[model samples]
Target chain A: MVLQILFIAIALAGVALFSYNLKKVIRNIRIGKAANRTDQPQKRMMTMVKVALGQTKMFFRPIPAFLHLIVYAGFVIINIEVLEIMIDGIFGTHRVFGGLGALYNFLIASFEILALGVWLGCAIFLVRRNIIKLKRFSGVEMTSWPRSDANYILITEILLMTAFLLMNAADAKLQAMGAAHYTAVGSFPVSQFLMNLLPNTEGALIAIERGCWWFHIIGIFGFLNYLPYSKHFHIMFAFPNTYFSNLEPKGEFSNMQSVTNEVKAMLDTSFTPPEPDGSKFGAKDVNDLTWVNLMNAYTCTECGRCTSVCPANITGKLLSPRKIMMDTRDRLEEVGKNIDKTGNGFDDGKSLIDTYISREEIWACTSCNACTQACPINIDPLAIITELRRYAVMEESQAPASINTMLGNIENNGAPWKYSPADRLNWAKES
Target chain B: MSEQLNFEVPTMAELLAKGEEPEILFWVGCAGSYDERAQKTTRDICKILHHVGMKYAVLGTEESCTGDPAKRAGNEFLFQMQAMTNIEVLNAYNIKKIVTGCPHCFNTIKNEYPGLGGTYEVIHHTQLIQDLINDGKLKAEGGESFKGKKITYHDPCYLGRGNGVYEAPRKALEVLDAQLVEMKRCKSNGLCCGAGGAQMFKEPEKGNKDINIERIEEALETQPEVIAASCPFCMTMLRDGVKLKDQDQNVQVLDIAEITARANGL
Candidate 1:
C-alpha cells in the first residue's frame, strides 16, 4: 500500500510538471503574429505521418539514420511495457497483463530485444558525439550546455533501459524460485541471459526487482519533465512542425499585405487604403514573426543538417542556419521571461536584430532552399533570415549600397540595370 | 560569327491592333533584354519560335521587371510596386500562356503574380522545347549533330529546386544525339550559380570562395565540351567561371535554347 501511494504521487507530480512546461512553451509560441496553417487538414496529417511517423527524411544519412531508427522504434515499442508498469504501479499488482498467456510472453520477448537495441544505439550515439566528434555536433552555437544536454539524454536513456532489463532479470529469477505473485508469465529471450548474474536468494531478488521497478518509473517521469528544456523537445514538436511547414513551391515568398495596400494607394489615387494600424513594416523581433516561425525555432533539434548544406556556410560565410534557430529560441525565451515579470509585454529594449543575429549573418544567405530541403523535420531557417532582412530593408531603409543602387535602377528604369524600357526590344534587332 | 537570319518579331500591341492575339507571350526578362551575352540566347529563342510556326508576341516596351530580385532582396514594397505594374500589362494583353528564357521571371510570373489577381499559364523555355520535341514539331535531325560530343546540363536554382522541373531540361538534352553527363551536384541537389537572390547585383558577403566558382568546379569535374544552362543569370555566371579557369578556349557555355535552336536548324 505504501509503495502504491509513493508510485501514484511521483507519477502525478511528473505529469503535472510536464503539463506546466508544455503550456509555457505553447504560450511563448503564441506570442508571435498569427498565421494561417490550419488550411488543408488532410494534407497536413499526411505530412505528419510521413515525416514524423515514417521517418523518411532521416534516410539521407544512412548510418546515423539506421541507428536513430533503432532508438526511435525502441522508444515507441517499449512504451507498451510502460503502460503495463503504470497499471501495476497503481494497483500494487505484479505483471497484471501476464494473464494474456502466450501473447504477453511474445510482447515481453520482443520488448527485451528492443531494449538491447536502444542500449546499443544510444551507446554508439555517445561515442559519435564525444569520441569521434561529428562536425555537425560541434558548431559554434553548440557551446557547453547543448552538448551536455545531448549527453545527458543519451546517458539517461541507457540507464533507464538498464533498469528495465535488470528488473525483468530479477523477476525471472523470482519466477523460477516459485515465489508468490511472480506467476512465471514472461518469455525473456535477452533478459534470461541476464538472470544468471542476479543473486539467487528470494529476499535479495525481491528487493532488486522492486528497486528497479521504482527506478525505471521515476526515471521516465524525470525524462518527461526534461524534454521541454532540451533539444529533445523535437520528439513532440516534430509532428506539428512538419504539419505546419510551407507546402507551396519553395521559391515563392509570401507577399506582404500591408505593403500591397500601400502600393495600391500610391499607384491609384482613387484607391482608398485601410486605416493605418501602426504596425511596423516587417519583423523587428519575435512579436513581428508569424507563430509558425516561433514554433519552428522551438522545434529545431540542433542537427545542423541545414547548416551543413548551406552555400554561405560552405563557403565560410558567417551565417549558420542552426545558429539562427538557436538565437530565435533564446530571444523568444528572454521575451517570455520579460512578459512573466511585467505581466504585460516585451520591453527589453533589445530586439532580435543587432542583439542576437547580426547584419552580416542574415545578408550572407543566398536565399537558397538547401537548408529547408535538408531539414529532416522541415524547419525553415531561410524564412527567419528573410524576415530579418525585410525588417532591415523596409523598416530601417538600410541595405547594402549595391542593393540600394539596384533598387533605384528598378524604380527609375524598367530593369535592374541602367537601360531604358524602350531598349527592351533591342535584342530582337540583333542577329 | 554566324549568318544573320531575317525574321519579324511581333509585339503584343501590334498584334492586338491588328485584331489578332498570340498563342503565347514571350516574357523577355531584364537579362534577356539588355545583357549582351543573353541577347544571343534571346535571338535563338526567337529563331526557334519562328521555325516552329508558333504564334508568339513579346510585351516589348510595356514589359517591366518581374520584381524577382527586388522581392529576394527583402524590399517587399519595391517588389510589389514592380509586380503590380507588370501584372497590369500582362492582364491587359489577356495573355493565357507564357514562356520565359529566365527561370527567375518564370517562377515569379507563375507563382507570385497569381496572389495579386494576375494568373496565367507560365512555363520555362526548356519545358516548351520539350513539349515541342514530344509533339514532333522540333527535331535534332537537320542541324548540328553532337553524336560523339559530351554535354552537361546545369540545373538553374529557380527552375530545378525552386520548381520541380528536373525532367524537362534533361528531356530537351536527351532528344539531341549528344551524351548527357551530370555534375556531382545536379537536379534537386544542384548548387546555386552565385547570381540568385539579387546576388547578381552585388558582391557576395565576405566568403572564402564565390558560389559560382564552387558550382563551376563541380561542373568541370564532368569534363564536358559544352555546359548547357537555361537561366541567363546562370549563363553569365557559368561563362565567367569558364573564363576565370581559362577554359573558354576548350569549353563552351551555351543556353539550352541556343543549343536546341542549333540542333533544330532554326
Candidate 2:
C-alpha cells in the first residue's frame, strides 16, 4: 500500500510539472503576432505524417538516420511496457498483464530486445558526439550548455535502458525461484544474459526488481520535465511545426499588407487607407514575428543540417541558421520571463536584432531555400532572416550602401541599373 | 561571320494598335534589357520565337522591373509599387500567357503578383522551349550539331528550388545532340550563383570565397566545354568565375535559349 501511494504521488507530480512547463511554452509562442496556419487541414495532416511521423527527410544522411530510427522506434515501442508498469505500480500488483501467458511472454521478450537496441543506439550517439566530435555538433553556437544537454539526454537513456533490462533479469530469477507475486510468465530472450549478474536469493532479487521499477518510472518523469528546457523539445514540437508549413513556393515571401495599404494610398490619391494601427513596419523582435515563426524557433533540434547546406555558412559567412533559431528561442524565453515578472506591458530595452542576431549575419543570407529544404522538420529559418531584413530596411531605413544605390536606381530608373525604361527594347535592335 | 538575318519583334502596343493580340507576352527582365551579355540571350530568345512562328509581343518601354530584388532586399513598399505598376500594364493588355528569360522575373510574376490582384500564366523560357521541342516546332537538327561535345546545366535557384521546374530545363537540354553532365550539387540541392536576393547589385559579404566560385568549381569538376545556364544572373556570375579561373577560353558559358537557338538554326 505504501509503495503504491509513493508511485501514485510521483506519477501525478511528474505530469503536473510537465503540464505547467508546456503551458508556459504555448504562452510564449502565443506572444507573437497572429498568423493563420489553420488553412488546408488535410494537407497539413499529410505533411505531419510524412515529415514528422515518417521521418522521410532524415534519410538524407543514411548512417545517422538508421541509428536514429532504431532509437526512435525503441523509445516508442518500449514505452508500451511502461503502460503495464504503470498499472502494476498503481495497484501494487506484479506484472498485471502477465495473465495473458504466451502473448505476455512475446510482448516482454520483444521489449527486452528493443531495450537492448536503445542501449546500443544511445551508446554510439555518445561516442559520435564526444569521441569522434562531429563538426556539425561543435559549431560556435554550440556552447557548453547545449553540448552537455545532449550528453545528459543520451546518458540518461542509457541508464534507463540498463535499469529496464536488469529489472527483467531479476524478475526472471524470482519467477524461477517461485517467489510470491513473481509470476513465471515472461520469456527473457535478451535479459537472460544479465541473470548471472543478479543474485539468486529471493529477497535480493525482489529488491533489485522493485528498485529498477522505481528508477525507470522516475527517470522517465524526470526526462519529460527536462524536455522544454533542452533542444529535445523538438520531440514534442516537430509535429505541429511541420503541420503549419508554408505551402507556397519557397521563393515567395509573405506580402506586407501594411506596406500595401500605404503604397496604394500613395499611388492613388482617391484611395482611402485604413486608420493607422501604429504597428511597426517589420519584425524588430519576437512580438513582431508571426506565431508560426516562434513555434519554428522552438522546434529547432540544433542538428545543423540547415547550416551545413547553407551557401553563406559554407563560404565562411557569420550567418548560421541553427544559431538564428537558438537566438530566437533564447530571446523569446527572455521576453517570456519579463512578462512573468512584470505584467504584459513589460519592456526590456534589448531587441532581437543588434542584441542577439547581427545585421551582418542576417544580410549574408542568399535567400536560397537550402536551409528550408534541408530541415527534417519544415523549419523556415529564411523566413525569419527576411523578416529581420524587412525591419532593417523599411523601419530603420538602414541598408548596405550598394543596396541603397540599387533601390535608388529601381525607384528613379525602371531597372536595378542606371538605365532608362525606353531602353528596354534595345535588346531587340541588337543583332 | 554569317549572313544578316532580319526579323521584326513586335511590342504589345503595336500589336494592340493593329487590332491584334499576341498569343503570349515576353517578359524581358532588367538584365535582359540592359546588361550587354544578357541582351545577347534576349536576342536569341526572340530569334527562337520568330523561328517557331509563334505570335509573341514584348511590353517594351511600358514594362518595368518586377521588384524581385527590391522585395528580397526587404523593401516591401518599393516592391509593391513596382508590382502594382507592372500589374496595371499587364492587365491593360489583358495578357493571359507570359514567358520570361530570367527566373527571378518569372518567379515573381507567377507567384508574388497574384496576391496583388494580378494573375497570369507565367513560365520560364526553358519551359516554353521544352514545350516547343515536345510539339516538334523546335528541333536541334540542321544547325550547330553538338554531337561529340559535353555540356552541363546549372539549375537556377529561383527556377529549381524556388519553384519545382527541374525536369523542364533538363528536357530542353536533352533534346540537344550533346552529352548532359550534372554537378555534384544539382536539381533541388543546387548551389546559389551568389547573385540572388539583391546580391547581384552589391558586393558579397565578407567570406573566405564567393558563392559563384564555389558553384563554378563544382561545375568545372564535370569538365564540360559549355556550362549551360538559364537565368541572366547565373550567366553573369558563372562567366565571371570562368574568367577568374582563366577558363573562359576553354569554358563557354551559354544560356539554354542561346544554345537552343544555335542548335535550331534560329
Best by lDDT: 2
Query: What is the Å distance of residue A253 in model 1 from its true position?
Result: 0.5
Error of 1 at A299 (Å): 0.8
Question: Which residue runs does candidate 2 get wrong by more than 4 Å?
Answer: A344-346, B1-5
lDDT of 1 by residue, A1-431 (tens): 99899899999999999999899899999988878888998998999999888888999889999999999999999999999999999999999999999999999999999999999999999999999999889877899999999999999999999999999999998999999889999998898899989999999999999999999999999999999888999999999999998888988999888889999999999999998778787788998898999999999989899988888888878889999999999999889888889975567689989999998988888777888888999899888888888999998988899999999999999799999988899888765
The lDDT values for all models are 0.90, 0.91
Instruction: Please name the candidate that would achieve the greatest DockQ relative to the true structure.
Output: 1
Give fnat for candidates 1, 2 and onward, in order.
0.71, 0.79
Q: Give the per-residue lDDT of model 1 (tens digit) for B1-266.
A: 15355877899999999999999899989999999999888888888888999999998999899999989989998899999998888888888999998999999999999998789999999999999999999888778887767999998888988898999988888888789999977887788888887889998889898888888888898999999999999998999999998899989999988888888776
Cα RMSDs, all models: 1.5, 1.4
List DockQ, one per candidate, in order: 0.76, 0.75
Q: Residue A13 in model 2: shift from native, Å?
A: 0.7
